[model samples]
Target: MSTAASEPEETTVKQADQTETPLESLASICTVLAIGLFVMTFIFQNYKIPSGSMEKTLLIGDHVLVDRTSFAPPTKWAPFVHYRDIHRGDVIVFYKPNPETPDLFLVKRAIGIPGDRIHLVNGIVYLNGVAQNEPQAGKPVEDGNPQHAFDAYRDDFPSVPPPPYEIQPLGITASWALDLPNHIQNGDLVVPPGMVFAMGDNRTESEDGRYWGFVPRQNIVGRPLFVYWSFETSADQMSKTSLGDRLSFIGHILVHFFDETRWRRTFHIIR
Candidate 1:
């Protein structure tokens, strides 16, 4: 037994400390915040429906998650991301193409794309000389119903020019009223290059492209992916911007969060 030759066995394995320093923790938090900010600003957006224009599909008080990248212009940096031309029948969110109200954002279905010929007959949309079968489009009330009145300006579109502002100031922007005639050719409204003809699912209720004008390709924000949440909110609630009203509504939401929430509409995908 050569005890002198047997040297003390060396212990090479040691436990490493895993606790994070304050600076490391701060860096992690900053990284997360940066990613979130990028996502919210350029990849996805949150929008709350303020009107019933896209009703049945998107109701007032329905908060939706919009995909901002799908319709965005393609870039050299993000080759893996999907980017496609806006197709007819796609539900789109865009800015109102009105000189007076340039910042108003609206959601409507794409009825016509560039170079497409569009017209309407009896509230039915005809695109590119072919009538589209859209089950999502709403119909007017039956004859004798109070809401059964028809407006040739809306249902017929371009055939009867937008009414005089003095007669009806709510629908049809001033600029559109002036420029509409230039686009009407052979009884069809020809969508110019880089323009989209958009309409609401509720044809009678939606003050869409027919009222304002074509949604410029550059003005499109994105398409709603799904309804993240929905509440029983009135259309006028958006106009109640007073501080007292805001606080009252916040209290009302706290008390009625469970009951007033439209649970069935939660996470409902927008078509």
Candidate 2:
């Protein structure tokens, strides 16, 4: 009788070890998913390229994973965490202040830091009184007139745009441009403390520091880690306002995902 009872007890123990309760299984799944979501929303973020503002380097429909921890200073309790400085030429994502939009995030290259003298001569960027060697400046955009081709407000930094077209400066840039003369020293714009001068890799097409003024240190987001996905969709498709257009774009993506996807760009590291 004792031996028979022990056999049944052993069988029950094995059964309990082999099968998980429904609640236990669900809890495990929830834990895994919660961790994944936390990592996605906090440590890294997914960003879609809406325009060619960062062309060549970051094209339209290119999805990037921005690393949030790189620029985050370590806490005293979390001193073991890896942290690095935001160096020049780093591609960073940040919140650019815009009254129209609530959360306007933009990606650009960091050109100058606090105390760095930044200026542009005929569109070539000079940092600390020296010309920057940026091979990724992209192709020059053609703006109709050959004479004024290199005379946009972007081309001649630290100086107001030539007469007649001088009224183009807007908002914060306009305010900064008004006081730009005070900051200019020997033709270079000295970056104020706690601010950074940022621009886009596609210099000709980018509406960056040249138009907007310096980016504050607090506005600096983390760097772009890699291009996770790249699609051939146009910029217009990104803002599919109508329901039909949105559904159609979704169907198109599902049908032509392989053909329209840029396979080479997937997992490409951003410099």
Candidate 3:
């Protein structure tokens, strides 16, 4: 009968509605976000290739889906192997070089393990006194000639010229790079404990441990599982005419919109 009594009922209804709305909204949002995070973290993680370091094996612009759980704890049915036992030839992704500027990730093949002695002779990789049989090595190549020549020149003529410039340009040539009595001798470089040597399949183009030093085992993220998708950019994607060719700069961009190689490399396996 009193108007005040009706006011209390309305207030109670309003409080109940407010509480129910937030709970319902929160539950819905949490369910969707949980599923998305789980899919991205455990099932599949996406990666984009930034360089040709692993060319022919993994091309630029290739989008790969790494199985996060592949090396993780095995299922109850199969529990023998673990991620700790990483073997050679595994394509692994790890934190990029330069700890201060650590955003981009790198992918390379495991070449040498802890306690392994690695040396290069005439562009051939000898591991532990045995020539490694690299079925996937595209072509054998070598670097570090200038360093060797400079060292030799310093030993012979310690007072002539200086540290680096003393070595002549011809000394850096591949044919004459290791031309010393002890040049072909094997230099035993033991792999430091808990470190692994990684090299790219495209040996000539890779800046790996052979240049920058060994990759500590902690930096390793996971092994590459599969190539999920690939997008190939056509030659026209770049400026076709540099004021000399037939096509105009604007014309090339217009043509490239339709000239993209969309399906040539999709779903290809990362060998």
Candidate 4:
């Protein structure tokens, strides 16, 4: 009986059966990276809260999905996108002006829009010379401090005097002091075009526009669409970036992911 002849592997069959050529491997990686970059650069991006600056609205460890296109300008290369202007009371995510903390993105309320006049007294905000109808600002907090219950700059806007509380921080609040006369008209801080005056929901604890300066139109990344996940982590733990601390945090997440998750906060919209 003649044995069946051994089949010789064809060159085409070998090429097709190869896991992938070097170029193809690179192509696959590039495709994945490109998609990720595109999503991060244009459509959506993630942000995490490391502090209680935004408090009840956005607590520490609240992971948010920010819609980058929400404020994206019309582009010639892309489709005709009708992006709306930023609105007052909208919660926005932006890069903190402090260059030292480049990765520190802060979440705050868009209290004053372009060309709007803003005034705050004892943490009570006034918009366009009228008391703002702010449900978020009025949001009750659990702060127990009675004295200095509001904030330091309660009486020092429009004509931001040398900060009475201490050496004025070299921030927007300081700039306002230098450009005091120009920025003030009728005793209200007039938000210049392409700049917004931002504040935190937990006004007393936040170091926002009242401490620093305006959030430049470009620094406004996007408004958070919703809280995708919220883990019960403290500000101290969230702020620690050491290797040991990070590993510990990761271990904690792995062990208590389900137990620590703020299930009620998931999908909670950011105003």
Top-TM-score structure, candidate number: 1
Candidate 3 — what's its lDDT? 0.62
Candidate 3: tens digits of C-alpha lDDT, residues 29-148: 999999999889865689977667787788775778775655454578546545455577788887754455376588898877888776655444677888778766544423554332
Q: Residue 175, candidate 1: how far off, in angstroms?
A: 0.7
Question: Model 2 Cα displacement at 90 (Å)?
Answer: 0.6
Q: What is the full ranking by lDDT, best candidate first?
A: 1, 2, 4, 3
Q: What is the lDDT of every predicted structure here? A: 0.86, 0.79, 0.62, 0.76
Q: What C-alpha RMSD separates each model from the true structure? A: 3.9, 3.1, 10.7, 4.5
Per-residue lDDT tens digits for candidate 1, residues 1-271, read: 4765454322222222456789999999999999999999999999989988887788999999999999999999999999998998899988888767789878899989999999998888888788889887876656775444576788887789877877885567778888889999999999999999999998878888888788899999899999999999988998999999999999999999999999999889888
The candidate scoring highest on lDDT is 1
Q: Per-prediction TM-score, please?
A: 0.90, 0.87, 0.60, 0.80
Candidate 1: list runs displaced more than 4 Å.
1-16, 143-148
TM-score, structure 1 vs. true: 0.90
The TM-score of predicted model 2 comes to: 0.87
TM-score, candidate number 3: 0.60
Residue lDDT tens for model 4, 63-150: 9999888687877776765588798888888887656666678889998988898877656787887876765553333477652354
Better of 1 and 2 by lDDT: 1
- lDDT for 140 in candidate 1 is 68
